[model samples]
Target: MRPRSRHRVDELLRELATWEPKELRELQAALGGLQTALERESSKTARQPSPGHIEEKYIQRGNKRHGPYLYLRYWEAGKLRSKYLGKKPE
Candidate 1:
């Protein structure tokens, strides 16, 4: 932590020692609620998608092009793989 933030936290903690048991319990409950909320939010953004490239592909048959589908090109286990997403525009 930065020096200023550390000083503020230390000062706040020192003041906590002077609080009564009832006040401390209330503080603990409030902090517990806040901690739960923060953890829940943290887990949500943590499940990120693997880094990859989105490509548009098509297949030619006779005299026609079949599709312009979306594919995710990602590397795994020392090999490249293409994951089909959908036939959507880029």
Candidate 2:
């Protein structure tokens, strides 16, 4: 087969880039729909009163040489929990 033309390849690349914004909009809409569905499900399955409002406590750690670090502590269960949404501390 003959090689593809450079001009044709550039045109196709430009078209692909131009399609990105529309694709992103579609993705955002789908995500919003999914979020709404999840919230509806959560509301239907409630067994207890919603947890108290989540609070974020930012703290700094580490030394000057190693560089300081920022962390978040959530107040729950009468304690300061260092995890967010069950995710391990980074």
The estimated TM-scores of all candidates read: 0.42, 0.29
Decoy 1 TM-score against native: 0.42
Give the best candidate by lDDT.
1
lDDT of 1 by residue, 1-90 (tens): 479989998999999999998877656654544444445546665534443455679989999998898765655444555557688754
lDDT of each: 0.64, 0.45
Q: Report model 2's TM-score to 2 decimal places.
A: 0.29
In model 1, which runs have C-alpha deviations exceeding 4 angstroms? 45-90
lDDT string, candidate 2, 1-90, tens digits = 546697787787777676777665554444444454456546775433332222334444564242133233333435533323332245
Clashing pairs in 1: none
Candidate 2 CA-lDDT value: 0.45
For residue 67, model 1's alpha carbon misses the true position, in angstroms, by 48
